[model samples]
Target: MVTILNEQAEVDVTPLPRGGDGLWLSHADMTRATGFELKSEGLCRGEICVPVPKGRHDFARDDAIDIAGFWRYLGHPVAHDASRSVWALGTGAGTRRQALASLEAPDFTLPDLDGRPHALSDYRGRKVFLVSWASW
Candidate 1:
């Protein structure tokens, strides 16, 4: 099983066959899981085809493309648990660096313990830790 994630979403895609050393899935599964589909031109979504650089794709013998290789080639970082069943993909380091450079937190609205809605900008002049935990 692999878990596809971005800053705002997480989706689990299972029953994907494994390649020699990594997960592999069809372009359909790729679209369902990652919202990116391989088109005649390149990896596409809707009317946007992300132009994949030359030699980025490494298709397995069975035509199951390597999931890790695909994301890595696009500059995202991929990590798997020791069991190798749970995979987490994050935005590229360059994007994170750019976020830091901006010195602005992405806007979000969430409820506090008392069910009070709060946003990061609420404390415009205060420092926020914004700690989060997950038990998965």
Candidate 2:
């Protein structure tokens, strides 16, 4: 079994076929984990479909799709541990670029040094400077 970190939730999928570095999920698992289904048009989430690139044989096999590769193909980022059993999928580059262009920071809550929770949107109209750092 592997856990996929998508958006703000974690989806666990089982019955996975092994032997590849990329994550391969069954068609049903794909829909269950990501809500996207492979169709004649392409991978469809509701009415929106992204047509698969031509001449790409790596994305699909007998009964599985390479989700990690597909995410990369969609210009998104996929981060995982050395074991490749845990994966985190990020939004596509276009979506991220649009967010930056809007000039509005995405709402998120974080803890201050004193452990008080603070959300960026809490000071919507006020000027606030944010400093974040980590020591490795």
Candidate 3:
């Protein structure tokens, strides 16, 4: 059993594909993590249904549905651990598409060299060039 958490909730479930993050998740796990179910129409939560793309509705060797693949097909972001047990799926394609359409960076506060915080919104109309390099 693996525990997956999002911003608001967490659920324990068996992740498919043994050890690899193969885009698949057990139906129960997927439904609990996301409020949607893998329905005939698509991933549906309540009255709304986001149709899964044809051929992309592939399955894992164990026959679990590929929830991650569905999200990727819709252009949503997702992340999981090396164990393929935990996951953090981000906002769906609709939300991201709207953000992309607006072309606005979400407001963020970052710390400068002096430990002072700078908010992107503070320079609303001005252009800022950020050149960052790190020696890891």
Best by lDDT: 2
Candidate 1 backbone collisions, by pair: none
lDDT of 2 by residue, 1-136 (tens): 8899988679998746666678888989888878889888888998879786555667766678888888887788899988777889888879888888998877788777898988899998888887787996
State the weakest 10-residue window (summed lDDT) of model 3.
54-63
Tens-place lDDT per residue, model 3, 15-84, is 6654444555777777877677877786798997987666545542234666667666557677888865
Q: Model 3 reaches what TM-score against the true structure?
A: 0.54
C-alpha TM-scores of all predictions:
0.61, 0.67, 0.54
Error of 3 at 28 (Å): 2.4
Order of candidate numbers by lDDT, starting with the best? 2, 1, 3
- Pairs clashing within candidate 3: none
lDDT values, one for every candidate = 0.70, 0.82, 0.69
The per-residue C-alpha lDDT of model 2 at residue 19 equals 68
Q: Which stretches of candidate 2 lie over 4 Å from their true place?
A: 53-55, 100-136
Put down candidate 1 lDDT per residue, 40-122, tens digits, no spaces: 67777688676655555564323456767777866888888787776777789887888888977866878878989888888
Q: Which scores greater on TM-score, model 1 or model 2?
A: 2
Off by over 4 Å in 3: 18-20, 53-56, 59-63, 92-136
